[model samples]
Target: MSNVEHVTFKNRDMYWEIAADIYYPPNFDESKQYPAIVVAHPIGSCKEQTSGEVYSAQLAEQGFVALAFDASFQGESGGEPRFTEDPSLRVEDFRHVADYLVTLSYVDAGRIGLIGICGGGGYAINAAMTERRYKAIATITGANYGRVLRETEGSAEAVIAKLEEIAAQRTAEAQGADWQVDGGLPESTEQAKELGITDVDILGATEYYKTTRGAKPNGLNKTLRSHMGTAYGWDAFHLAEELLTQPLLVVVGDIQGGFGAYRDGYEIVRRARSTKKELTVVKGWSHYDLYDKDEPVAQAMSKLTPFFTENL
Candidate 1:
């Protein structure tokens, strides 16, 4: 059991207020400082989503202080250009959350850890690389959104065309056009059918984000189209084999015929420099299954709880 409460803090990058939830152990004692961990949500997601709050609550139940936060310019966080999914800023936000964690008298600053879900996982890796304050780090069904985009959208010509489209949007906005939004996954079941989007990875993800299963109004599947280039250039595990020296845990799904998490998690596990690292593949779980659903969560948390406990 754990106690959940709303919290807010500033992002050091620009001092903008970021929204978050603090999950404390059910028997939390303010007089005693406890190890803490930061939980990062997926791209286009908020603190309330499955991977963010769900994992935070679970960790808190295990006697760890957990903080789940919305990235800057998305969810309930304060920032202009709403829904800007900048990788650099996202990575910096993790460190900023760590900064907030250390300020709490009941949080053990030196023993802090981090858990990131989906796209957040990549940013967490980037953050953990230089922010040694994170003694341990982990990502579930992790993905480098930039890399995912590249794989999904083929060709240099296609990329150049996207860049051109974004550039045109920027110009149109300057000419007083309405704020254009770039939607990610389909927002409704009807829309999925209309698009003929049958990819299991995307279909599974939409089920979580577009349906009542894990949907949040403020967390619609959209971001500014201008963020395309930023996401395209940023690499989540930019220096894994070389600079990521912290204890790393990469949990991938063995579902979708084992292509679910392997696409990203396996590569990271292969390259990360952590002498203490583990890549646990959850059987019969698809990429999106890790977001919620009782069985998959149980499978993922079994390993995560122990990993954080042993390391953090």
Candidate 2:
């Protein structure tokens, strides 16, 4: 196994700092430049919480330079109103990472690629729409953040109403009404348990977000800014359709009921006039199965190594 080093860089006019872990292959040589992959972590989670860091380590062992990063406003990165999620800024963050990577003597600037997990996958595809420098892109168990925000578990009208309520809370806070947001998990009820949420998928997501599994001491589950809602504005489908010049690889668990995102994104890539694309579906795997399991992780890495090796 090769040693991985933790590092940080600045972005967004230096108003923000991005934290990352760089994995160097055994007997790494500065004299020889290598293909590089930027690995982005899941939404509401830091680099270390998800499998982004682990996957980067494996990529390093396979003789590639892999850098896993904590997105802006999360993890060790600098951003106001901690834990606030912004899709546009997230996409720009990926571009900034590519800019930072190309400056390193050990990185092959022309051969840079990206690997995004979960929510990060959507941002990666969104970034590729404008960041042509990225030669290849890959995603695992990905989610289209915009779609989820607009349609998951609630109707569009209902979601808008909830957003409005949050905004009102923010207004009250600005008026110094002694407003305080809950910094912990939502309580589980028997009704939730009957929905197959034995642990944290449905009811436990609240707990998971508040605990060490996905939470940081400075992170927040609620934001006071109304513009935060606007972050989910762009259509990932449109982004995929427009940015099909680069080679892409989409991987998903076939049994996961939420594979629609992967299917839709892959179809866009396949229809592109200039891009070459491939899709891999793992049998009997669920949404979170690829997060840390060794078998699925290994299979994903195997597919990733060859795809980037050939395209990037």
Best lDDT among the predictions, by candidate number: 1
Candidates in order have lDDT scores of 0.83, 0.71
Query: What's the CA RMSD of model 1 in angstroms?
Result: 1.9
The TM-score between candidate 2 and the true structure equals: 0.85
User: Model 2: runs farther than 4 Å from truth?
Assistant: 12-14, 177-227, 258-274
Instruction: Give one digit per residue, the lDDT tens place, for model 1 in 238-261.
Output: 878899998889988877522235
| Model 1 TM-score on a 0 to 1 scale | 0.95
Return the TM-score for each candidate structure.
Answer: 0.95, 0.85
Clashing pairs in 1: none
Off by over 4 Å in 1: 257-260
